[model samples]
Target: MNLEDYGEGTLASAPLDVLEDYFAAHGWQSERNGDEEIVAAVKGSWTQYELRAVWRAEDRVLQFLALPDVRVPEDKRQLVYETFGLINEQLWLGHFEMWAASSMILFRHAALLDSASPAGLTLQQAETLIEAALDECERFYPVFQFVLWGDKTPQEAIAAALVDTAGEA
Candidate 1:
């Protein structure tokens, strides 16, 4: 099925349909806000996350932005920036970036799709991409909470949040 089959006024042939299918299979709340963008709200251990995926067919890139929904204050921007660098270092895929305009921290990743493939993206590929972003978001969520609300230094936040607890507490 193509985009046009979804409804009237929508056009055909976009890669994000695979992403939309992923959302449907998982039963998460998501919507296609535009021809190339889909936003999904997911619940995590620490907070609600907004996952946004954009398909750029011309570039054959499906860009994803995962938001933990915590706003960084102006004063904490420097520490947040520092923590972002630290957290991103440990991430094998994707990275953290601060939107200076909105004082928002976001996790960004992208998948290079095969434009030649009519299927665009497979369901497995969609899950892998989206899950990896969310996993990163959940893993380091406390670091942001520490710096933003607890007023901890970047070093302290990372240290405290990443403590490797063994067995059941």
Candidate 2:
């Protein structure tokens, strides 16, 4: 029910439980969607995104996906794609993609958890990955908005996003 219940241990064997507890510990409302999936919603300053953590037993990896509420219109597909290319390169951990068939955009990352490896999952690692995905979503959300609704060119949107704001501080 909580992080305290699960003492520090190798998560290679119980990644799902570890992840569920981790999300719960962080006060994120989550529920098991099926045997190997947990769906959670995280709110950002711009919007809320649904984060899904799915354990692929066959591959021994935990795949996390975040889908923002923004949808790319057919006409804006090229602009959105161009914007994602720039954003994806800047990402160190995960990548963003536009699913044309679904007309949805998602941020995705994976953590390998080979049971035989000495390195096991840690709360810090999981947290870092999840946060990275969310941070990417938050950072690029406005760019997508600019392309989708603000009638801004992809180049313009990216330039606006990359403007240095530390000086404003």
Candidate 3:
């Protein structure tokens, strides 16, 4: 279905379709996973990142996840864990997590829709979340590289990744 189908003020009850359509409209490749999930992929400088959106009908929440291609080495798990705390605190939306079993790191964000209606679940909101997730991934990826390969401390890595824009404004 197209985005225009859900006009302003109308409840976007189909969370999965809405997410899929929104991503597809932006030229991102997307596909359904089983019944409740849609996975979309976008290319980045380092690698391709997979963004997954899962619709929880019962809870009325759409969960967005972006999995970077980088995997934390077993030896550097502790360092990465510590770095995640620093990164998460600076974030205004979503958080980073590591899956021990798979040795993979992921960025996740979620939006809760009104159970009675989709008053706040607009296409613009969905796009904003996806854009934020991707931006966060791009920004922090180098920090992970520093911890894993450059043997830098979390503080050093964060400091290196941060860009000072005090005078630009």
Candidate 4:
């Protein structure tokens, strides 16, 4: 659907707006940029840092865009990988990782609906929506699997199933 359908200046044009409001209700000020990015304060049990959500909508399709956290580098990407594991360990903690984890869930679930059985989505005319969504989720790292297994790789069984179903969309 186009932004206009949601109404001018309405929250419909941006999913991040919903997320920002959700965070703000919890006492956090979610700063948005260019209608595509959101950065917020994250409080750990004993520490705090800025958490960011970089997102984009292109060709009327939406995906969770990655933030350019320059503070995180190549060597630190490994640290972020390990941080993925650490986040799993503290899944219940209210932190940036928690938001990431939650965001992953929301996106992936919507992707599933978009791809396998849109049911009633207007985009059903576009058969590749599900595959596109899965492709994006896979690229972004399936946080659900990361949380459950502490690894970025999908389970062999799931990988094989996905591969088998790859063209079903």
Candidate 5:
């Protein structure tokens, strides 16, 4: 995505197409953006998680599906936003709800990764976790229905495989 090109202090909002291109290049797909929201899928090993880039007053922000359920520390969310070149403070200002901005899930993911909980995550289990997370994401943020990262089948297949693996385990 060459996010470095955007740099800091750029007042211009990242166009939806540009965001799509960046995510697409990373193997993300099935993007759906409307007047108020943008949604897509992301690949995590063998599973896919839904990612929502909600528009906040013409500025684009990220929100993940099913992240509210994940426990994470504060400050981590802001780092995720920084990684994408979005101002985390702007997205979080005055928003008391976790789902209102993209930071919460990112923070949780970061915490999880840092803590090594995501290590040794099988493809099937990973898909199941992402699916569960997306369910929460949809419940909290309904304006999402895009496919980014990998195709829908891989996600479903990973989920199914996880279920089978669980039975065996």
Candidate 6:
């Protein structure tokens, strides 16, 4: 979790070394800051995401966070919280949370560094997690907007955004 794990003259940590390679292969702009963390910018349909992946060797956990390009207003914090709870209920993988200090909604997922992924995680798993995070953000972005500015309740906002369509409109 710190520079000590990386040792002198080491550019990156073990798990993050693998993740750094994954970022490079995809041509995403990423910087492995020191060792334990890598921050990348990824574009989603709805907005750009600031992707942060952290490797905690002590706990054998890889924490991933995708932050959608929106900031919740102070007045709508309560509704945003409620909508996020509903959104979390519908999600099977990662969940949405507000980083209270910034009021930024984030999609968070964690993976155990196990035998399957010796380097904390594999590229395929990373792809899946990233896609899921982006998809969820794209789908729910408008709902957040509705609650914040369109005079819609949290339930109403979710209902309006979640309706399924048959084909291209």
Name the regions of candidate 3 deviating beyond 4 angstroms: 1-13, 118-120, 165-169
What stretches of model 5 exceed 4 Å from their correct place?
A: 1-14, 58-169
- lDDT per prediction? 0.82, 0.80, 0.84, 0.38, 0.36, 0.80
TM-score against truth, every candidate: 0.88, 0.86, 0.87, 0.35, 0.30, 0.86
**Candidate 6's residue-wise lDDT over 1-169, tens digit each?**
3324444444325667766666788888999877689898988777889989887777877788899878888988999999989889999888999999988989899877673333546567777777787788888988988998898998999899889889887
* Residue pairs clashing, model 1: none
74 Cα displacement, candidate 3 (Å)? 0.7
| lDDT, candidate 3, 16-68, per-residue tens | 77777787788998988765798989998777999998877677788989999
Question: What does candidate 5's lDDT look like per residue over 70-98, in tens digits?
Answer: 32235344433232232223233211134
- How would the candidate models be sorted by TM-score, starting from the highest? 1, 3, 2, 6, 4, 5
RMSD of each: 3.7, 3.1, 3.1, 13.1, 16.3, 4.9
Candidate 4 on 1-169: residue-level lDDT in tens?
Answer: 4323444444423555544654576686668776656666644322343444444444333433222121333333444545445433432312223233323222212221122222212333222332333243343333433434444443432343334344555
Question: Clash pairs of candidate 4?
Answer: 115-130
TM-score for predicted model 5 compared with the true structure? 0.30
Candidate 1, 17-59: lDDT as tens digits = 7777778878889999776899999998989999999887677
Q: Which candidate is the best by TM-score?
A: 1
- Summed over model 2, clashes come to 0
Worst 10 residues of 4 by lDDT: 104-113
Ranked by lDDT, top first: 3, 1, 2, 6, 4, 5
Poorest 10 consecutive residues by lDDT, candidate 6: 1-10
What's the lDDT for residue 11 in model 4? 40
Give the deviation of candidate 4 from the true structure as CA RMSD: 13.1
